[model samples]
Target: MYRFLVPLACALSIAASATAAPRLVEPRLHIDKEHIGPARIALTFDACMGRVDMRILDVLLRERIPATIFVTARWLQHNRQAAATLLAHPDLFEIENHGAMHVPAVDYPTSIYGITAAGSPQAVAREVEGGAAAIVAAGAPQPRWFRGATARYTASSITEISRLGYKVAGYSINGDDGSLLGARAAEQRVAAARDGDVVIAHINQPSHAAGAGVAKGILALKKSGVHFVRLADTVAPHPTPVL
Candidate 1:
């Protein structure tokens, strides 16, 4: 009986340690992604779900603008043609992980800005890994970066995700509020971007009026001489982890 209790105590100890969030060297941001070179801006699209924003993609492709795309498993399952289309333009885009179920990568099972987080550190890791595996199984290269649902993270969750070998992709600009925007608002949000800002917008809502705005903003940025780049070209993700 004593031996059984000892094992139980040890198990509880381990679980307790695992539940505690790690100390991060930095504070996490609502959108923490960085950008490219001096005159360059990184335009990142999040396909959270739904049909491809051909309105936005068309302009990017027509202009030969480079971009980074973050995709979820559900989005891939539902948008095969879109995935194939993106893969066809490898030079124009880098496909990265969004998560298996669009779960927020946070330390516990509470809502943040209406997002349901993964609840535990291990669950967060699974979300990151599952997203990567799904993307790889779909035939794209292994993703070097991940941005969880809502592009928000607790400092510890982001740190743990970084430890799993993917840089937690944060954005310098919220280009579209989850694709909820009017054309003018979307255009203003993105067009107002400064050099070196990693812009985060959506490619999941083609029917959304904001999609057209995203296109307009991209074109406006191009017209203003802002060069586009892939996240890879800017940051060599997977630096030595602080943890």
Candidate 2:
């Protein structure tokens, strides 16, 4: 009886492992230089649940730089004025879906960087669809791109997202490390962006100094003659796999 139980337990362990979500390396996307031309970079800001970082938005407006702003349903719900501000400048800002609740797009029970994931393929779909619905309801066009919270995903989640007909938005440069960097650090990171780089920063943490730095960095990039483009203006295929 003991031997039989051991084997059964082993089989169950194997089965569980087989069905467990496989965490893949976080995807990094970039502008295809051949397709996007030279001296151009894509700036993408994540408006995860938080107040609008007007420092960054103000710079974009003043400089007329084009950006892709990925927003969650929660952010939009609490930031109607900011959303309207973004929509007010359709020529400069293209809002995309971040997620329904800023949850990582992982189709399993897990967490990325301490944030809980969406947990299942079905939940992932609801997240994607819910965020899209919220965006449309907020008066923005249907979001064609989806950038999951934490920018991490499992293989199954990526496949699910693709099956849903939205291109996943990834980034080549992390400008603020999720708004954790100091002003100088964020400024230097973003100011260093080059042609065909897709930079990710946060526009939801106004209290953080990183937003101010990001603002400065954008001005620096503009001063150096770097052209900014929205994600809609260029085709960014699935970024090169990190793993």
Candidate 3:
């Protein structure tokens, strides 16, 4: 199962209403935390598709920043050498499950942007477990966290995924807005991050402008004395129930 190219329709689904509430039937959910501490933050990257952003990888390697990377099976197939390289630095990177095919992690019949939800509880589990299987097959440690295709999920889907024994990793900051926010805006959004934020940006698609912004913002944060930590160092809080 592979997602050839991210469907453009996924844009609207990924950019769901910022003012909506999360419902069991259909929910738009993510986390919002001002600061986890005074000067500590966690940087999580997504290798969802496309080429690995060496620019982002270079900064993390040079600074030795800790990051939790959510990798989809499709990406693993596309970037094996890079994944192996990242795994070689176990101390700096924690590999996690994104999904088998980069499908939205929901059981609803609705289509997000243009990507359809997994559609059934069982399908969701397969999407998740398949991703983990890919990681382990590559000789990496089993993932402890799962971040869905577009970071969106139904309430039940979250519960189901949790029941499977992995916590869903949601970010406090949308650093790249699925990589639509230009490099500068993406950089500012991340650089202005408060303490304890779990910032997510794509490590795939190096050509995208967002990756560039994330690198600069990460570098700026490092210079400002902000300590970058892994998702496991602290905790990836579950999303709150939408109002």
Best by TM-score: 2
User: What lDDT score belongs to each candidate, Candidate 1 first?
Assistant: 0.83, 0.91, 0.83
Writing each residue's lDDT as its tens digit, candidate 3 over 1-243 gives 236346655666667765354454322223334445548788888888777989999888888988889999999998988998888999999999999999888876667778888988899999999999999998899899888887888888989999999888877778998888899999998998767677888899777898899999999898898877787776446655442
Model 2 residue 182 CA deviation in Å: 0.3
Native-referenced Cα lDDT, model 1: 0.83
What candidate 2 gets wrong by more than 4 Å, as runs, is 1-21, 35-38
Error of 1 at 55 (Å): 0.2
Comparison by lDDT, 1 against 2, better one: 2
Name the 10 consecutive residues with the lowest summed lDDT in model 2. Answer: 29-38
Model 1 weakest 10-residue run by lDDT: 24-33
Pairs in steric clash, model 3 = 9-113, 9-114, 10-113, 10-114, 36-195
TM-score of each: 0.82, 0.91, 0.84
Compared with the true structure, what per-residue lDDT tens digits does model 2 show for residues 93-195? 9999998899898888888899988899999999999999999999999999999999988777888999999888888899999999999999999999998
Candidate 1 wrong stretches, greater than 4 Å: 1-38, 236-243
- Arranged by lDDT with the best first, the candidates are 2, 1, 3
Deviation (Å) of 129 in candidate 1: 0.7
Pairs that collide, model 2: none
